[model samples]
Target: MLQTQSNKSSFFVKRPILFVIVVEVLLLIIVTVGGAIATIKELDYIAAIWVSFTPIALILVIYLTWKRKWGSLGFQSLSTITKQNWLYHLPLILVLITISLKGFEDLSVSKVIQFVSFTLLVGFVEETVYRGLILKAMLNVGVKAAVITSSLLFAVTHALNMISGQDLANTVVQIVYSLLIGVVLALLMVRGSNIYPLILFHFLHNLIQFLGPEATGVTYFDVIALVILVIYSIVLIKSLNKKTIKGSIAA
Candidate 1:
């Protein structure tokens, strides 16, 4: 019986994409069900969101243990940050700064702490699942495929927000920009070869959205940032391909 279980585990290890998809589906179910329960029971929604990630974290640990592929999940040292990398990331940094300038005046200490904790958990789980596991799995096909597929999956997953009572039109816009951000993030991960920076950036980005001034509508700055993000993503993708070629030649 142990041997049979081992064989089944090995099968999943050999087919990582299938394993990742299964895990993603399970996570989706957890999020949906947990949100529903929270709504019905009048539970603290923030706490519920945090709790929903517990199973995902557990699954990540199990997969890492089973495959012994922690390094592949961006647990290793980051690649060198070149001038190009800084340039590619500049727009995002600017956006973050602008958002931070919006300030945290009205928030209490406890609320700030809670929001930080929630954003950190979100950053860790989402990046691990999308950029780490899903991207790693899709890399078996090719880098381009991995980037596009993982980004699409990441964007699509945000649809869950609508179920949690988000405005439909706003959610649709979010899904679109999220797809672009997802692509940029995937490319950044490939170029940097580390997930920690992405996690930090993701957390800050989310926190900004939570605390920033109320949006009457999409602003000109938002459109500019989106354009910059797309341009940067393309450049990063090319950089990744060049690095791949160099590695191939070295090998």
Candidate 2:
């Protein structure tokens, strides 16, 4: 039997735009305050991330328990990935390849454990919220609007780094790069309707970047990567728009 959502008349269900805004604000406060506390305590980055996102994840878990709409939010198994949408999968693969270029700087047991735990938590929390919850809610607006709005908000969330003392220039670049990646991930969620692969890839990508030698500063490769992602995002938006429009007409 199909388990329908119990809260059909709830405020969030009726006001998805407002729901998105509230969620964004809640995440920003939770994450930013956690990061700030970690900094003040001189804690490790791992602790900072765990402190910040773990609560958010648990809250979503509670919501899922109440609603039981896991599949609707793209939390299905990996087998649900649409093998037919091969092109939609390439951008994330390419980004993963780019991230893997960063060679490992540590391989100790504790470090590896931290790497796995940290990356998994980061990937799961972020992918679940941004691509799963936010994107799904924004879809009530329209495909293009959902993609653009969620992606832009995802990028904006990175501004929290500036509060933690990251340099202005690097933070700006990160925001832009995150926005492009957001677009790719959002498109994948909509077309493929599966998020397991996204969570896995995000885990690996972050792990690889952490493994690699720390950059002295942003390099030419960063610029190249950003430009490539921008072009790919544009092509995807155009292609997706055309297909969705055609489908709407046929319906």
Candidate 3:
């Protein structure tokens, strides 16, 4: 057992990307099989399966195979919020406004609990895997490359939703939107040096989407909201870049 564990550790250290890919494939298999079983049985257990299994698998892999610290995987305690850190709040503001506009109605306690739990799980798992492990692994190449590569991977992973019977057009939109969101969250993680806020924002965004009023079809409002968010993210990234350059010069 010890020799086998050592070999696994060495393998992951030598090929972190491959490790991530293998773990992701495992997750996809688990979700696909679990979801199919749930559908066949008419049970609402997909969220529970994903929420429980993905994180546990990721934690075990990171702990046993990779030997990485949890803090390195974005499990750090909250940091002090400065002006720079405060900009990370923009996404949360947008989420809240969108939810308000959608006019949330009261939900049963059980449904609310389910929505919140699933969103929080998604936020934790995705950030830890993509922004935490993958982004950190790629940083030796360059920060820009790391951010872009991780964000793209994050977006592409949404294609799995298609296998779960999501509409193709909607899934495409989700993929694009996820790319944008990933970039923004990645920058925020860099700026804040903490991933807790990103997890919270991600959870809030998903919760809003889940509980807020559903749209009948694509609307102008959705386009406008997306545009505003993209613009905000661009400005935020530029601002953070400027700060970094100035700090480097002063140092």
lDDT of 2: 0.77
Would you list the C-alpha lDDT of every candidate in the order shown?
A: 0.73, 0.77, 0.66
- Residues 169-249, candidate 1: write the lDDT tens digits: 778877878898899888876665567778888999988877666765666666766676778677776666676533321
Q: Per-residue CA lDDT of candidate 3, range 1-251, in tens?
A: 01244443554445766766776676566666766766776776545466445655566555634564455445656654466568556655774576457667688999899888888878777777777767655553456866787898898777767777778877877787788888887776666556788878888887887787774555555666677669867876776675552322121
Ranking by lDDT: 2, 1, 3
In terms of lDDT, the poorest run of 10 residues in model 1 is 1-10
Candidate 3 RMSD computed on C-alpha atoms after optimal superposition onto the true structure: 5.6
Per-residue lDDT value at 196 in model 1: 77
Each model's TM-score, in the order given? 0.83, 0.87, 0.78
Best by TM-score: 2
Instruction: Report how far residue 101 has shifted in candidate 2, in Å.
Output: 1.9
